[model samples]
Target: MVLGWRRRKNNNHKGVKQNVEVIVPNHFMCPISLDLMKDPVTLSTGITYDRQNVEKWFDEGNCTCPVTYQIVRNLDMTPNHSLRILTQDWCVENKQHGVERIPTPRIPVSRFDVAELLIQVKASARGLDQYGCLELVHKMKRLGNEMERNKRCIVENGAPGALASAFDAFANDSIERNVNVLEEILSALNWMFPLKLEAHKYLGSKASLTCMVWFLKQQGLSGKEKSIVTLKELLSFGDEKHVEALSEIEGVCELLVEFINKRISPTITKASMRVVWYLVSSSSPCSDKMKLAFVELDLVSSLLDILIESEKSLCEKALAIFESLCSIEQGREKGYSNYLTVPLLVKKILRVSALTTEYCISSIWKMCKLGEKDDEKRVIVEAFHVGAFQKILLVLQVGCGDKIKEKATELLKLMNPYRAHLECIDSDYKNLKRSF
Candidate 1:
């Protein structure tokens, strides 16, 4: 009887283990949200899951049964759908708004109120605390949006002169005060309404540029400081039309030239280079002041130096500036060779070869094109230290298989006629022709 009882107990234990092996397909839900396991947070007890405890999860390309811990084969448990659902819910909760969301006072607020708001925005930005600035940016964004929607109301009825008057006051205030406010507004708008049409309406306007330049000049910003000011302020000042007024400033060109000469921080120097490029690209009448500035600053050499040191983007801008300069009728005159000549340009091109692949190719293409156009073919021949044909043959030999080589080859064929003066070409023509 004792042996029979022990055998029965063992059978019962085996039966209980079999029952435990039975798997449930959907046995549990997250307690917090009552949804399928999201962030399946584990606990210290090793038996419970919680939402707050979980950071994130990955399926590893298969689903594991919550109860039996068996991997579900041939199941597409990629988790992409789960992530989308979570993100969609998160966005909706964060962006949902009500009618009374606007924060401006019902009554018209005074200029001082705007000034105070601007000060707070500046303080928040200076601290570099994103959360601290968020509230102020939201408020400004709401105000700017409201003003735009009611633009017809303000401009036509003139009911609330307060906001318009405040803007005018800010625009005409002392340089330091006005610029500080403008900077704050710009920063706030950039953050709060990035890519919003209302943001463009608020920030991109002629009035803004007028005010900004006035403030910049009043602060006596020039050279690197002026470059920085332009760099930070241009996008907020709208598009190409706004550039006209800024470009017309007496010292603006000189400031750009100084920026190029002093080797300002690459960021500021790049910005200054862009400003010059736009000015030249527009085909605006070249002012005597601009020319004199370029001459005084020795802009050609400075630009070449930048081409040698800067990355491809800056080098591209520098090349564009060079092209624009050459496009002007006066730029094509004989005397201009004093600034841009075959020897100096060749040296600069060689220096650029070490900078970037795009820059090196561009420099080579420009040099070859210049050779084809130059009236002084002797200068090109002398500068390359070989006969024109030999130079072309050497370029073909050392070519890197970039598109620029093709362009260089085309220009070489054009300049080959000038090779009649070279002794090497006469002796090597048959061999060169065979190779070609």
Candidate 2:
């Protein structure tokens, strides 16, 4: 009876195997790539599978035949013998054809994007294992380099959308949590593409600027040290391409001046003053946007104030701005003269001589030229003091030449109503001649 039972079971198994072979197809193919399965791997979506990753698919409960899209049960693996033969044949054909199947490369993320990612990792660091957080931070640094490279490409191409997208990703990904990371990104961006038009576009866009300001505040950059650093970065390139964008940002110049005052460091103050000087000196027309920087930030007064307190180099820069303001025809057309007093400015000019004899002398000479009218002449006369006269005479005595001496004598005569000053100047001239 036992022998009879064993024979019946064997017959049943044979019948099941025959049925499985009849049902299963010999070959399977992927619809998308239209290639025989190399390593049939299942995707998280459950709909896609690669023949090359068949074992992985089965491990993940996705033991489905790629050709028929039928789920093959793990326990009934024996049923798919025909499919296996077909996969082996396909692999051999693929090797013969030299059809190399490479995985798609990931799109390189920007430094801005990596910064955003680092911010997220930093926020969650407390919860993550220390080693994991460290690893993420390291990954973020690598991503930052990729971002810098992409930004360089965008800058060269003049692609605002690419820059905007990069900034947007950064804003959405990282600016909210680790504000310092955003700062690092901004610093990097500022350094990499200091004059990129796309950066200006991003800065001008209300959304981007607002987000940046928010990030700045969060990073404790709202103060003068940070603000000045930011502005210096903006104006560092000193390129004509950046001028329009620099003018576009409302109150940037004034904010920069205010920052300089607050920060009060010689280096920072010097750099900030230089940027303002560059803007005024550049031939580009100052826009209402740029004028707004003066109006809102009281930049003129701030500049005058800086002239009062800053170091020699900073003072020279401020004086250059003054000189440009006085000389540019637009100053009168733009009614800048109406807003600022030449006489008060002249007094400030005289004060600069005490700071640097050469600078003050040069400034006075320029101021005298600006004094074209009688009223302007009278103002110059009243403002000029004996100290200024002595400096002018000293310059003349040192043999500044006939033209300078003539100008100085004329200026001196205007200042000295009585002829008593002439005796001192005549003495200095004789003394200089005697020495020579």
Please provide TM-scores, in order, for all candidate models, with all chains considered together: 0.47, 0.43
Score each candidate by Cα lDDT.
0.44, 0.47
Clash count list over all predictions: 0, 13
lDDT for model 1: 0.44
Expressed as tens digits, the lDDT of each residue in 123-202 for candidate 2 is 44434233444454445445445544444433444332233334444555554654444444354444344545555554
lDDT tens per residue, model 1, 1-436: 0110011122465554221121112323443334434334343323233232221222233244343455434322222334334433543443422111112123333344456665665565455444444565456555555544222222223212222223334444443444544444444333232233333333334454455445434543332344244334444434554455566555667666766666546765776777676665553455334544464455665655554446667766776666445433344332244433433344444334533333333444454455345643444454444333444455557664656577556656655665565444222211121110
Q: What TM value does model 2 have?
A: 0.43
- lDDT at position 266, candidate 1: 73
Worst 10 residues of 1 by lDDT: 1-10
> lDDT for model 2, on a 0 to 1 scale?
0.47
Candidate 1: RMSD to truth = 16.3
**Candidate 1 regions off by >4 Å?**
1-169, 172-174, 189-207, 214-239, 283-297, 329-375, 382-410, 420-436
